[model samples]
Target: MFCTLLWGSAAPFIKWGYDLFSISQTGDILVFAGVRFLLAGLLVILAGSLLQGKLLTAGKAVMTPVLTLAFFQTFGQYFLYYLGVSQASGVDSAVITGTGAFISLLMAVYVFRYEKMTANKALGCLTGFAGILVMNASALTQAGGSLMGEGLILTSQVFSAISAAFIKKFTRTHDAVLLSGWQFACGGLALMLSGLAMGGSMPGASAAGWAVVLYLAFVSAAAYTLWGLLLKEYPLSRVGIFNCIIPVAGVFWSAALLHETGQAFAPSTLAAMALVAIGVWLVNRPETPDKRSENQTCGS
Candidate 1:
């Protein structure tokens, strides 16, 4: 939960970092995305080696899936997120990213069949999305950014959902830390190569810019590793419920950092948040015997 809160705070900080560095000056969006991921990946690898003694070695059989997971989660998802943040406000970006839980639930039900959508879950999903709408309503008036960029952020959420499902598939056999390190390494390498291809260069970066990069590398990457470990140990349904706290934390952080003023909180936002919180609690609480039996029968 603490890691998630920290990760949530990263959006505004990353936006500030991009502003300080002007990452676009190097070349293109891909370059900017690549550099951040590459640096982060290297740090994770180093951390894994120092903390765990050695990295996990996968057989040729599992290498492809791991790479694919990395590509979706680290490369595709974050590349789009960075581009979106560059185009939009941190608050906007954070809320959109928070929508990933809803997308993940949909994917889990329809595609993976790992979970069913009960009434409570449906209510929770709707309430959570309503909260996002309430938050973004004010920003809707001033439309300076490209819709494409916003769409990209939403698309990244889908990729994240897919990656979550994929990661769950292999967690039983893999060491989460080693798996996370490899994913970061591969994803970071992919980003760096893309950056080089686009003629990206990191010159004249301010101390603040470097600080942001370090935070992203060490804290974000390390926290993500811990998250992977948690996911492996817990049920996805239960683990995912904690993600709801992220946006609430993000909104408060944005208000503090951006010095946002006079934004009236609508009753709907509170109501939506309340409903979602209740839904998460209900969904994750220990199921009654009848519910468990039903689930087992359904599986059979």
Candidate 2:
């Protein structure tokens, strides 16, 4: 819930950055993305070192998973999402990003064996998705942007799912903060290099640009480290369920910050939210003895 709230706050900041810097302007995307991740990576490393009294080092055993996580979650997912938001409405972007929960649930159940797929789980997921659809129905129709942008955003969710699965695997031995810092560092470096390769230059805003970069770096990145820790400590099914709240919060924040007006509590939106809430309940509810036995037997 805390992580979801923090993430929900991010849309407003990004929107502010976009409005101030014109996200689609030449080189702005690359510069903003690169700087934000790079600074976030650095800050995480510094914070981890201070807290633990030493730098967290990755060994060959953890290298593969760390790099895979960096590539997918840190770089691939955000790159696609930022680009999508740059092209589409914020509401659309929020909806598209919220799909990560469903993808993560599927991956956890089928690929990682983190959870068993049951009728209740399926219904829960469907209910949550329906809520998301309601939340974004207005923006969905307005998503007349380039299909490429939308495709990239959708594709990003796959990387997020893969990262969630891999992170769960590594949490067995590694500290979440250390792992998250390393992933951010690796991904941030990759994004910076990609920006340079694309001939993207830094934005020249005098104050606001730098402020936006700092906000993204410190708030978004550092908060995500905490989020990763929560995921490591809790069941992925449970952690992933809270993601449903992100869109709800995002819509509320967008209205509050941007003063964008629409039907804030439309009947469809309320119905969808109710379904999503029920779905989350189902997903996070304690398992019965039979379900628990099945989970243990399946080694989840």
Candidate 3:
């Protein structure tokens, strides 16, 4: 719940963060994303050390997953996502980003073999996707950003889903807190290096800009750590379904913060949220006892 809230708030704040820091180029967005994650990774480690009475630690053997996570999850995901976020409106970012959960679910089924693909999930994805399209239909023609902008944001979710699968697979023996800390740290450093190499510089932001950065750092620290823990205790679909609420909260926060009054509470936005919720429900809906019995009977 809190995890979803943290994520939901990100769309608005990210747009505002760009404005606050005057991010204008891809290099700048990368640098900014790098800074935010680097700070977040450090904070997560610090919090873990304090709460657990020791420095956050990881095993040498788990280094493979850590590196993979850093490359794919934090670094690859954020770099592209920032490009998308910068191009699209905040509301669009929020709505489109919600589709990541379904992407994760799909990956879980095919890549991880942790779940199976069913008709229900297929339909759910279509419904959710339709909602995403409705939210962005007008923008496709209005010339805010390329179709690539929305595409990149949606693609970022695939990496996010992969990250979750990594956590679920690895955290069987290791601590989620440890993995979260290391991946963020490694990924952040890598992203920062990439940004610097690409000729990106930190913008001269005001005090307010620093505040936004810090808050984003905190959000990642708390949410990623908690999300890691939650993944350990629940199946991916169960936990992932909760992520659907993010867009709703994101839209609200964007409206309130950015003062997008006319579009915030618009009919289309509400309808999109509703469709997504229903789609998520269909995705996460457990098989009924009768259905189980019927399957068993057929097998027999």
Candidate 4:
């Protein structure tokens, strides 16, 4: 829940950064995101080295997972997410990101086979998705969502789901924090290179602006680290269930923090939130022994 809360802070902060730093171009946003993740990666590495009292070495197994995670989870996901936020309202972005829960659930059940999909699980995902549709229906039709906006967020979140599955598979071999740190470093480097290639230039900004950037880095490092630890301890489905709270937190934060945007949320949003909460319950609820026995019999 705490990790998800930290992540929920992202959209509003990114919007605020763009305004504060005068970031108009997509390349510029990429550069900013790159810097944030780079530092986050470094911080995690430092923490790991300190805990071990020695420099950490990256072998083939470590580098393989780190690089893969960097590309898909850190670099690919954020690239799309930042770009999507640029073209969409913060509230819309938040609501759209809520889809991550469903994506993660699907991956957990089918791809990783980490958890079996029961009737409750299926209904839970459907209910959560229904909430997402309801929450976005007004904005998508009235305010309009472009391919660049909602589409990109949708794509990135699927990558996030894939990353979760990978993390679950990899953590048994490597230290979670170290893997997280390196991935963030690799991702940041990749993003900046891409941004520069795309003609992004970093301009001088206010000290406050830099502070905001650092805060973002800090948030990424802390949130991802905590999440890495959680994945190390829990099943992907369990950790993923908490994500249902993120969009609600994000929309609330955006409405509260970035009020100048004049985003008027509808009463239906409240009902939509209720639906999502219920969905979380359904997804997270433990199955009965009888249900598991029935499932095993069916499989046999």
Per-residue lDDT for 216-283 in model 3, tens only?
98989999889999988877866877778889888888889988767778888888898999899887
Question: What lDDT would each prediction earn against the true structure?
Answer: 0.70, 0.73, 0.84, 0.83
Q: Report RMSD for candidate 1.
A: 2.9
| Each prediction's TM-score versus the true structure | 0.86, 0.88, 0.93, 0.93
> RMSD per prediction, one decimal?
2.9, 2.6, 2.7, 2.5
Report the C-alpha lDDT of model 1 over 118-184, residue by residue, as the tens digit.
7656777776777666655655666663466567778888898888877777777876776777787
Winner of 1 and 3 under lDDT: 3
Candidate 4 residue lDDT tens string, 15-52: 88888888989889899899899999998889889988
Q: Name the lDDT of candidate 2.
A: 0.73
Clashing pairs in 4: none
The deviation in Å at residue 64 for candidate 3 is 1.1
Clashing pairs in 2: none
Segments of candidate 3 deviating more than 4 angstroms:
141-145, 290-300
Q: What are the clash counts of all predictions, listed in order?
A: 1, 0, 0, 0
